[model samples]
Target: MSKQPPLDKFERDVLDESVPIQQLLRLVIVLGGRAFSEPLRLWARNELQGYPGPGIPLPTYRMITAPLQMDSHSRFSQGRNETISALALPDVAHDLVSEQLPVTFSVGKLQNLISHQDPHTPLKLGLPGSAELARLMTSERSGQGVVVERIYWSVHASALHDILEQVRNRLLEFVAELRATMEPGESEPTVGQVHQAAQTINITVGDHSPVHVIAPHRHSATVSFPTRPHHRWWPRR
Candidate 1:
């Protein structure tokens, strides 16, 4: 029988606590310059065990349940504009900071890329090839650059503050290591735009009754539950 990969401290804690799925949040990490989709996907899969969605849940909770998706304009061609998203529950976000999983998992994965000097390494996860394209995008010598456009998290109001703190602290370490790996004399890459916004839904009454949509801005239409029933339906991200 194949041996299972060892779980990190955070992973152990997650399993120990049996963290419930409170809120599902979508985190989009946009790369400004060309990011080879295949290699990036491979890297995520091999190192993080984050594969294309719909994915089975893992202990890490930092699963990339979606594939590397590019903007509509760059769908057919290799373009600098691209996006990769992953899903994390509130409990998972908490562990990333509390258990220092970002340093061991996130930074460790990045360290693998910097240590391998060859850009043409075979495409293998946890191996050199899978990270080749990702390495190039971040390398100053390659001329092709990669910058984060933004990191947006669609979350509920209650879990916003806690999740934001975890993400911010973890991202600081992640970005720092990425910059440290750049070629000599290369300008350090800037941290990508980070936006945390509450998700909103428009609820319309089926009885032709006036509805009050409360939010900074409103768009999209959804069926509103009747107030008489006091039905509680929380939207998922």
Candidate 2:
């Protein structure tokens, strides 16, 4: 009988008795992708620092914090021929939210497992860039000072899911084709080669709670935050 692969640290941590999977699930957002860019490439390199064997590295864990900025613009018009000019506020408060605990996976092994199927097999995969946009508008005419407000919000949950799923499916298809084209006794392609060929990005938003704010208009405000976390993850060419 074939021996089962040993569980990695991440799997052990999740299955550990001390750390309840329920609470961890609440704190963690699981994201997987075959298309890897600088952010995930660097993460994989760092994670594989001491890993053994030729398989792809395990997932890496880190706490990422960054300043979020929001900007708004408003305009009012009476008719198609009329133009209205509104006051441009100099200083406006911006809402910022801090997210936590995002888990990322390389998923090369998973792709390899799926690639064992026939080359012509088809998988029902999601679209590439599914997204949702939300807008809200409020107006008060009877108030002493008229207040007209509009809010625009967007989220990429569907898009992220689509990219991840499609990337996996594509990887499977590529691997199947490669296997089919090889000689009868030729060696198969490595997981790293398959991963290197297919690169993608997948993100999961965990918590959207407002953490802190940096007001450039106010000198007293504390504006201490690291430069974008993804910048540090650029892969060394």
Candidate 3:
């Protein structure tokens, strides 16, 4: 029988619920660098650093649906924050107020947010173009002096937690598949082999479209992971 290899150890580490997401992510980064796959490295980097800008499309998993809220006050009242419907806003603001808002915070940042926030409180995200939308709303009112102060998307902490879970699950699926590709007794995989494994699972690894819509993996395994403990691992050169 073939002896356990480095890939096997890495696989075990991935399956260990105790391993922090950041550490696993760093390992992925190392693997990507070793494989010389820019796409692989880019995926890991984006997760660690958050998506850079609009130019880089976010993975479908990062998109979330949440309640749109508006904080406003009239000349009479102090301020009121309440859930606002998209229809209430001008047509110009409709697109920004939709259910799906891309979350671009890094893994560490997300964990920090969850730790600091109360479980019941929803995380508020200020939407772009909110000021302009507020102006439009005030103009529509045209008399009562109801000025909108903020327009934001309110997401539950659990929702953010779910994003981390999805990422972890996807990583588990990836490493398991990659390990399976190694020949018995092979301690390491070739660059071609690594690239092939990524392609088989439809992970973004190279020059393809930046956005990836995750699908059910053909090699999906039924496993439950423990709640991850907070730990951090910074990548090394």
Candidate 4:
């Protein structure tokens, strides 16, 4: 008979970047499967470095961690419309009463498992100033003046080719078909018009919860409590 899967370890940064969404549910399945089939008692023991607790059960524990920033933009919605705040990733699902999981969800493994998923694109991650239009923020300007900001982001250059190739095959065709239906006198979109467009192939996922996860896909629980803050969201001015 095939044996049950073992539990596995997961890292935050890698998983969040590469696989945080409901669509990429494979990540959670693979890791959780590994956790079930692998031996992870020592690793769980080590996670409790600060406070010594009896080793956390590999299958019974869960950890959900996510940090997000909210922004308002006019161009974000369908129209050049109202400014709205959307969660980069939603929060963990909760029961209104005990503030716990529904009785049906596995409670023992819930906290021990660490999963993070988002409905939108992953927040831009990289060297601070390079990705952000404005690097400096003064608390002195907190309540008052306006600031127009832009943060540029990108997927890995090497990987871009494959995804772009898919886009070329799919979305490009759709656009061409649509253009043909336009009025005979209509002009084609200019270079700038086409260049400014967003992706047609988007990976949809679960709620906005901060957890790096979709419903079934849980991100890795592996962590590196590095001595330095790799990237602090809002560093002290």
Best by lDDT: 3
In candidate 3, how many Å is residue 182 off?
Answer: 1.3
**Model 4 per-residue lDDT tens digits across residues 178-221:** 24443454433222222221122121212322212112122122
Cα deviation at 14, candidate 2, in Å, is 21
| CA lDDT of every candidate | 0.26, 0.27, 0.70, 0.26
TM-score (C-alpha, index-matched) for candidate 1: 0.20
Residue ranges of candidate 2 with Cα displaced over 4 Å: 2-152, 190-237
Give candidate 2's TM-score.
0.24
Of 1 and 4, the candidate ranking higher by TM-score: 1
| Comparison by lDDT, 1 against 3, better one | 3
Q: After superposition, how far is residue 158 of candidate 4 from its true place, in Å?
A: 3.3
Q: Give candidate 4's TM-score.
A: 0.16
Sort by TM-score, top down from the best = 3, 2, 1, 4
Q: What lDDT is obtained when candidate 2 is compared to the true structure?
A: 0.27
TM-score for all predictions? 0.20, 0.24, 0.77, 0.16
Window of ten residues with lowest summed lDDT in model 2: 127-136
In model 2, what lDDT does residue 103 have? 18
Model 3 Cα lDDT, one tens digit per residue, 1-237:
976555666678777877778887887777766666567677878888888766676777788898788888887885645888888878765654586777888988999899999999888887766666677777877787787887788989999999788778878777766668766765666665666566543544223454332223322221212111212222111
Q: After superposition on all CA atoms, what RMSD does each candidate show versus the true structure?
A: 25.0, 20.3, 10.0, 23.2
* Model 1 agreement with the true structure over 1-237: per-residue lDDT tens digits: 864322122223323323221111111122211121232223223233222222322223232222232221222334332433332112222222121111123323333443453443221222112133233223422333332222222222222223333433333333334334434544322222111111111111223332231222222211121111122122222
